[model samples]
Target: MASAIKRSRTSFLTALSLGLLSFGISSCNGAWRQRIGIEKQPVAEPLPEVSDGPRSAPLKPGDNVIVEAVDRVGPAVVRIDTLKRVASPLGNLFGGRAPIQKQAGQGSGFITRSDGLIFTNAHVVEGADQVSVTLPDGRSFSGRVLGGDPLTDVAVVRVVADKLPVAPLGNSNDLKPGEWAIAIGNPLGLNNTVTAGIISAVDRTNAVGEGQRVPYIQTDAAVNPGNSGGPLINASGQVIGINTAIRQAPGAGLSFAIPINLAKRIAQQIISTGQASHPFIGVRLQSLTPQLAKEINATIDLCKVPELNGVLVIEVVENSPAAEAGIKPCDLIRDVNGTEVKDPSQVQLAVDRGRVGEAMPIVVERDGERLTLNVTPEELPRQQ
Candidate 1:
């Protein structure tokens, strides 16, 4: 009986040793938690209950304006996740692609009207198979793409929720260099990242691209791939621009935004009508300097112009309003509707401000002769 009791004690001690050994090995493996999630054990193995995030500290006097700005508008900003269907490269042995692969992408946006209307970039939700928007308050909803205008890179999204936060819109026209600028977005999958800078410049037309001119607001704020469609805020917490693109080359600090004024104009049209129309005169132009004038004089001949600093017409699309008005290449643009235009952006802006289908009077210098031509504006095509 004593020997049997000793054997029983020895067996119990061995089992306890093996259990400790197994637990130590599993604890050292860091990835174990990912595979083995928390399991509820009834009273036998109790785990500490996790608490929600800490409450925000109360606001005090003399707070930084940037902090105040974020506190006001951060709740309105949302993260937009998208899934796009793409063809898979590793398909059947026949060298064909499979169409079942889904690619994930992310961006950011803000509420504008509070009735579920959100403004984002067209490239964010465009052609997406699925869109999901996550608010800052830990609520999410399936997003609907109401309308998207790729020409202006603006899109409107809708979600069904009550008491949505809205970011107030500001006049981008009133923005000037050196004003405080703030950026908030989900960059590199990190949500609600905030960065601050100043308005580096405004009315930057060439920042978007070579041909597609949008007067972008340039800022030094940090913007990344996932930061697209986020808001660029002013000192008063008003949204001045939509964070769009960043320079890929040297001076990588330069980031660009679509002016909120232009965005609102497009958004209003998309909300009311199914699409937005851009009035264009159908002419490509370059700002003429003395050096550029010299190049034109020595290059292929369409028309000759006196050496001057003004907007130089480069190409006129066939059957367009400019061609119909007899505005030819190498013609130096002097004025649009009697207002002198110093650059190509100003010329485009004047035409946009004027009524479409109405005759716009323009003056150009051709071979030392100033000629006035009347051209009617027309709606730009989607691909334009």
Candidate 2:
């Protein structure tokens, strides 16, 4: 009986030992599998919920003026394409008939009236045998040049279209420097390109090119090769100026535009008479300077003359209005039509406001005496 009991105890101990070793081997395998990423660990509980706080108000439609202005005026901008005939160099070498080649050019313009009247730069359609206008909707039409003023670089083109979108004209005289200026045009053949900048200056004269009497609005906007004649809009989506010339050369950021006030006047004249006219005084005038005043005072001895701040006449054309009115060289123009004159532009503006055949009363200080002279201005002769 004692031996059987001892065998039973030994068997029980062996069975317990076998159970413990099996559990240890299973645990070791599980650890190795976990370390090697062959088995996934138990997932942890989720984190507590947290709030991000209250949301702010949504943005208003008027928050973005640029986008609004573009949406308002962009459709009025048009692309102008011109084709001109050019003589081919190879024609001379071939000893054949002078070869005629079609030269294609592209520019920009804006509709000024709902009757399909468009305003653009004169140089855009100058010498073009054919002109084509393309709207933002991809519709193209053949355009006819109504009139062009090469002096102001303004031109009017008409298209036979109804219900055309017209850009609203603004008072350019009310424009102040540092205001927002938006330029929309096809630049470098890229249609509907928009650029933003500030009005760098106003009344910029003689900065664009020679013989431009109208004061130009200078801006830093990216007015490129194809942006000419496009509208330069204000923040209210009003057309303030017509983009015209860019300062060409390296480091070029200076861009100029014809003021809308002057453009409107010229366009009106062109529409009414099929030609624009400018008032001519028939004299070469120079702005008076301190040195020039001293030199004149020394030479002419114009005693009792008040502080000189006026334009000095350099030369007068023969049989011209200035010559007929006895306006000679070295005469200082003090006022025009009772308006005090300070610069040549002021005088120009006064003369521009007068009728071609109307008498213009001009005050000149000569030999220490201020003399009033009545001169009748004539229309400037058109260039041949």
Provide C-alpha RMSD values for all models, in order: 29.0, 40.3
Worst 10 residues of 1 by lDDT: 12-21
CA lDDT of each prediction against the hidden true structure: 0.75, 0.76
Q: What lDDT tens digits, residue by residue, belong to model 2 across residues 300-354?
A: 5323223456666655676676777777666778888778877666677667767
Best by TM-score: 2
Clashing pairs in 2: none
By summed lDDT, the worst window of 10 consecutive residues in model 2 runs over: 12-21
Judged by whole-model lDDT over C-alpha atoms, candidate 2 comes out at 0.76
Give a tens-digit lDDT track for model 1, residues 1-384. 000111111111110000001124654454555456654333543322111122233235455989987887799899999999977777564757564789999999998866688889999998898999999989999999888888678999888876788887777988889998899999998999999999999888778554444688999999998999999997777788999989876755789999988888778778766676666666766666676656656764544566768877766676677777877777778888878889777777666656567677888888788988877777765563
List candidate 1 segments past 4 Å from native.
Answer: 1-61, 94-98, 248-252, 298-302, 337-339, 353-355, 367-369
